[model samples]
Target: MDDLPDDALGDVLRRLPPRWLAASRCVCKAWRRTIDERRLLRPDLLPLSFAGIFIQFDSHAFPEFFARPSPSSANTKLDFLP
Candidate 1:
């Protein structure tokens, strides 16, 4: 599989069931990169973790959001006006 070109590998990965495709990602960095780069996995199908919540109070001009120090939230920014 390592010898296979990225396009070919991605084609093969796309054929696998979601479960198997996920396991294939753990095979190696190349495989993982191929999967991610091609977006072979459906994000909605994967398990989701609770990142945080946004609270808006009537008196407050802006909403307040709380999130764990996670990669997902590292670039999160709230820029809406109340």
Candidate 2:
């Protein structure tokens, strides 16, 4: 993996979801540099704003979810359980 050129690495890394891409910063200096330099984590670039979010803190089997709103709706604030 280390042998790949920066462009190749950036291409692959860009495919990762934005959250994971940010987490990858802790993986290593080289990858951090590539992600940072490419500015791939820009929030404005996200395809959609999630109108609904759901997560099960104790259930690892269910994947967390972010749902897009109906065309007539807009994103709303979410309050999670403490």
Candidate 3:
């Protein structure tokens, strides 16, 4: 494994599941701290664009809106204003 380049190892690390990645960080001091910081920093990195479409309708298409999925979670809450 030492023969492989650091970039190769980093590439493999990025493809791993979050749990395994976190565990791998514990192998050494630098590895542990790097992975720990990455986990903590992820939420702070948000995309520049946040956009969605809203299909508005009158009396005819109103019923269909209630049947659609509600997009709510621990962090985000959305309610239909209709």
- Identify the candidate with maximal lDDT: 1
TM-score (C-alpha) between model 1 and the true structure: 0.59
Worst 10 residues of 2 by lDDT: 73-82
| lDDT for each candidate structure | 0.88, 0.84, 0.57
> Roughly what TM-score does model 2 have, to 2 decimal places?
0.51
lDDT of 3 at 10: 67
- Across 1-82, the per-residue lDDT of candidate 2 in tens digits comes to 8899999999999999887888887899999999989988896754674578887767657867868646766556575636
Q: Tens digits of per-residue lDDT for model 1 on 2-44?
A: 6789999889889999999989999999999999999999999
Extract clashing residue pairs from model 2: none
What stretches of model 1 exceed 4 Å from their correct place?
51-82
Weakest lDDT window of 10 consecutive positions for candidate 1: 72-81
The collision pairs in model 1 are none
lDDT of 1 at 48: 88
Number of the top TM-score candidate: 1
Worst 10 residues of 3 by lDDT: 40-49
